[model samples]
Target chain A: MPQIFRRSANSYARLSLLGALLLAGGLIGLIMAIGSSSYVTRANEFIEQPIQFSHLHHVGDDGIDCRYCHTSVESSPFAGIPPTKTCMNCHSQIWATAPFLEPVRSSFRDDRPLRWIRVHDLPDFVYFNHSIHVKKGMGCETCHGRIDEMPLVLQQNSLQMQWCLECHRAPEQFVRPRSEVFTMGYRPAVPQSVLGPQLVKEYGIQSLTSCSTCHR
Target chain B: MRPNQNSQFRNSQLPRGLGRWSFGRWECAAILLCVLAAGCRQDMHDAPRYDPLEASPFFRDGRSARSLVTNTVARGGLREDDHLYQGKVDGQLTDTFPMPVTAELLARGRERFNVFCAPCHGRTGQGNGMVVQRGFRAPPSYHEQRLRNAPAGYFFDVMTNGFGAMSDYAAQVPVADRWAISAYIRALQLSQRATVDDVPVDRRPELDQAPEVRLPPGRPETPPAPEAR
Candidate 1:
């Protein structure tokens, strides 16, 4: 019984306590990693739509302005999805008889909306206004990424609160001139450090971090 | 038993199975943590209310957004101003602009024309836009004598009501923007036919200098062919 608790048992007990602490810390780190990862945030995921509409072809090749299709981006909280009539505007003549455009034609003829899946869906609790962002000199490419380059659009950023907070805390780091707000592949004529703060001041963009700013 | 011995007596009276099943402080904390972790449900993330364009099971069309009832006019949607809304006065398409034309209005017209009209009508009003190159019906050149003589309200009417092969842009371009575009079209008509005498003496010298070669906004340089992702 005297040797049941050996001197080496003290070292074993110390190591067990240290291992327990490490395990708890590691578990938290793993949770945080998973929470921010694309798997959880749905970033970079290509959603399947009723039609494989190509932003690359329209925006990149044809140089159609974003307002051409998303007509309400400047005026509405939700960027308006073009109706089937919008698609038929050009498709009626360009690809009038192509089999690929049958869905668009049918949708127009049948007066049924083509169910285009939303790519940048925010959580229901979070309120995002596209008009405000566009008005405040936030370039579409800043949040949507190089949409002109994406044949099938994917969400560019993590739609997590922390990801949003990055811009919300310091909007000066991301704002552009109002003229350049719609320009894709926008390069600041001056260094962003100089331009960003200037535009932020000019636009009077507030670093609103209150819970009501987004959550309400 | 004495007060000090009471606790010991009660512990001794507890069942052997109960004693073996008792949790340590760390084990109780771990169990609480697991319960809290499971509480991170997505209930708040996806609330019951519909987001814009969200599909709905209740509707026959599966749309959360309902279409406006036929002939339903919104408040202040009556649009009684015939000159502003219809581009007409006394049921005739007139030449006069409803609003006074200003340099600012022309600038807005230039921007709006580039966005909405330039796809079919070329940026220079040459009727050789990218869409025309892609096999869409070529619209008549704005520089043509017939179009140059056309009234401003006629252009507005064509935009409000479909003209020949071109569909009406009433849905895409707002009423104010249509007039602005009409003004821009007039400017474009004048540009192609402008003589040196048209420029003021002071500004005429600047015209001799090579025009700045910058591409308009949204007009990217020749893009590479679409690569499969």
Candidate 2:
């Protein structure tokens, strides 16, 4: 009991309590940061595909429309991946003998599908319909980013629940005219502030945030 | 050790009085937080269901989407309307359209054509499209007398079954859209050959002011009018 604790121990004890609280908060914050970061979310990451198809070449230079290959985007829940025949539609003649396109050719000749990697895969619980979004004036570029500039396509946005809620909460901030839904690099002729609300009203877009809106 | 077994062993080793003890509020809270953190596994993120085009381990082809068996027609897929599905009447290509041609249909056709056909056929059906410029075989110009004289069903048949170097677009273009594109092709044939006399009396004056420069096919100068929708 003879001076077992120094007088300075009081301040040390106080500092240790504060440090413990700070360490807990820092741990929680770090977990949250990791949860939303590109490492977990896979945003802005280019996935390797069966073929190194260039969106920049097809969309930007050749000016092929998105609907050309994603034929079911306007009518189905899933935007259809183009069958190998779609690739051979041009590659059969344009790059007929190019060794790089042998996979595309073999897939066509053998009638087997090319195992193209999916980029924007959402969690199994989420149900996204391309047609409804397209109908409601959601541009492909809005979520996919500048796909025409992507040599190899990448997931343009964090396909996280909170990220989806950003648009679902205020669709007016993002919607364009339905006609411009497929147009890449779309710029609002009127300022978005003026045009977004009008288009939202016109398209009858609801800010559906209920769990069932996506979960079901 | 398994968590339950470890806890059971610890409980057996505890003194009799301490064995009946409960955790403090902080200990309980910490345990609850640990349990909650542990619940963040990817079980829900990757539930046992195939997403569209997901690979399947069971199928030899590794496709979750199975191909339709030969001659297996889906419900409501009989497609008995030869005029619509095959572009035929009495086994001959018919010139008449199954649906009435409207301004709306033309607009839809123009949009779909640009998306599905304009790469090879060109925006004006001139056959010198971007793909042709890129060294794909140049298709016959729609303005050609041969194509102009061809029946509407002939164009639809060509799109449905394909001809010469071109492949069939039946998989990509729906039946209704093929007809619409056929109508639009007829319109293009007319456009290239039309003289001043073809312009309506009321619109003739507007034509004289300035020949409006056509933008690229997909980029319409104006959003479709409300009535168009």
| CA RMSD of each candidate after superposition | 5.3, 7.0
**Alpha-carbon local distance difference test for all models:** 0.88, 0.90
Which portions of model 1 miss their true places by more than 4 Å? B1-21, B24-40, B212-229
Tens digits of per-residue lDDT for model 2, A21-120: 9999999999899988999888888899989999999999999999999999999999999999998889889989999999999998998889888888
Q: What is the DockQ of candidate 2?
A: 0.53
TM-scores, each model vs. reference:
0.89, 0.88
> Number of the top candidate by TM-score?
1
lDDT of 2 at A85: 93
User: Model 1 Cα displacement at A109 (Å)?
Assistant: 0.7
Docking class of 2: medium
- lDDT by residue for model 2 (B59-82), tens: 998899998999999899898999
Off by over 4 Å in 2: A1-4, B1-40, B211-229
- For every candidate, what share of the true interface contacts is present? 0.57, 0.64
Which TM-score values does chain B get in all models?
Answer: 0.78, 0.77
